[model samples]
Target chain A: MQYIYAALLIYKSGKEITEDSVKAVLAAAGADVDDARVKALISALDGVDIEEAIAKAAFAAPAAAAPAAA
Target chain B: MQYIYAALLIYKSGKEITEDSVKAVLAAAGADVDDARVKALISALDGVDIEEAIAKAAFAAPAAAAPAAA
Candidate 1:
C-alpha cells in the first residue's frame, strides 16, 4: 500500500519514477525500502502511461463523483 | 481511497460490483457512504476487467515483488 502511494506521489510531484526516487520517497516516509519491490514497480510501470492510469483511477475516485441534479 | 478498496474487496470476495454491493462494503468498513460515489465506482468498473487490473497492481506490489535469489 505504501509502495503504491510512493509511486503515485512521485507521479503527482512531476518527478520521474526511478528506483532511487521511489526509494527516497519510501525512506522519507520511514518505510523500509525494498529493492525488489521498487524494481517490480518500475518494470510494471514501464510503457504504462502514469497520467492516463492515474486519470482513470482519479476519475473513479468517489470524491470526484458528483451526482447529477435530478 | 476507501471507495476503490471497497470495490476491490467485493471483487476479491467473488461478489458482483453493483452499487448496492459497493455501498455495503463501504458501510461495513465504516466509511462515509456516498450514493454518488458508489454509482460512479460501479459505472467505472462496468465492463472493466477487475481481475486483470488487480493482478497488475498486485504484481507491482512490493510485498509480492520478491526478487530472485541472488
Candidate 2:
C-alpha cells in the first residue's frame, strides 16, 4: 500500500514515476521501503495513464440507478 | 492508474482483492481493463495492508517543522 502511495506521490508531483523516485519519497516520508514492492509497483504502473486513473478515481462513486426520463 | 483505482474500489467495498473483482469494477464503470495490468496490480498488492495504506495516504502530508522544545 505504501508502495502505491509512493508512486502516487511521485505521480502527483509531476515527476517521472520510477523506482528511484518512489524510493526517494518513501525514504523522505520515514516509511520502510520494500524493494520487491517498489519494483512490483513500477512494473504494474507500466503503460498506465496516471492522469486517467486519477480522473477515474475522482468520479468513482456511481450515482443512483434510477431510470432517466426522456 | 485506473487499475489501482479498481483495486481501491474493491478495497473500499470491503471485497477480496482479485483480478475478477477489479475487472468487474472497471467493467461497471465502463472503463477499459487491461488484463495484464490487472494481474500485475493484484500481484503488487499481495501481502499489503490496504487499511494501513489508506491511513498513510490520509496523513500523507508531513506537519510543518517548528521548534517546540525549550
Candidate 3:
C-alpha cells in the first residue's frame, strides 16, 4: 500500500514516478529500499497509467487478506 | 504490488498461495492480470514466511522507488 500511496503522492503532487522520487518517498516514511524489488516493481509498472491503476487499487485486492490469513 | 497483496490475502485467509488464488485476488481487485508476472512472484516467494515478509514490507523496499527512477 505504501508503494501505491507513494504513487498516489506522486500523482497528487504532480510529480513523475521515478526511482529517485520513490526512494525519496520511502525515505520520508523511514522505509528501507530494496534495490532488486524496486527495480522489479518499476519494470512492472512500465507504461502503466497510475491514475487508472490507483483507481483500480481500491477495488483490487483485499488489504487485510494476506495478514489475516497468515 | 498486487502480487504482494495477493500473498497477504493468502496469509490472512490462511490459504496457500497457488496460481488460482492469486488470480482470484487480482480478479477481485479489478486489476490487470499478468500471468507471467504472477507466476514469477509465486515462484519468488516459494519458501518465504508471509508474516516475516509483511513485517519487512513496511521496512523493506520503498513502496514507490522503482517507476520514479525508470
Q: What are the runs in model 2 whose C-alpha is more than 4 Å off? A: A1-70, B62-70
lDDT of 1 by residue, B1-70 (tens): 7888888887888888888888887888789986655665665566788777776433222322233322
List A-chain TM-scores for all predictions: 0.78, 0.72, 0.68
Models sorted by TM-score, best on top: 2, 3, 1
lDDT of 3 by residue, B3-61 (tens): 88877887798898987899898999998877766766887888988787556555433
lDDT tens readout by residue for model 1, A1-70: 6778999899999999999999999999998766756765686689999777766555455433333221
What DockQ do the predictions score, one after another?
0.03, 0.06, 0.05
Task: For model 2, name the residue pairs that clash.
Answer: none
The local distance difference test score of each candidate is: 0.72, 0.72, 0.71
**Candidate 3 residue runs with Cα over 4 Å from true position:** A57-70, B1-70
Output the worst ten-in-a-row residue range by lDDT, candidate 1 chain B.
Answer: B61-70
Say which candidate scores most in TM-score: 2
* lDDT accuracy of residue B49 in candidate 1: 87
Q: Distance from true position, residue B23, model 3, in Å?
A: 19
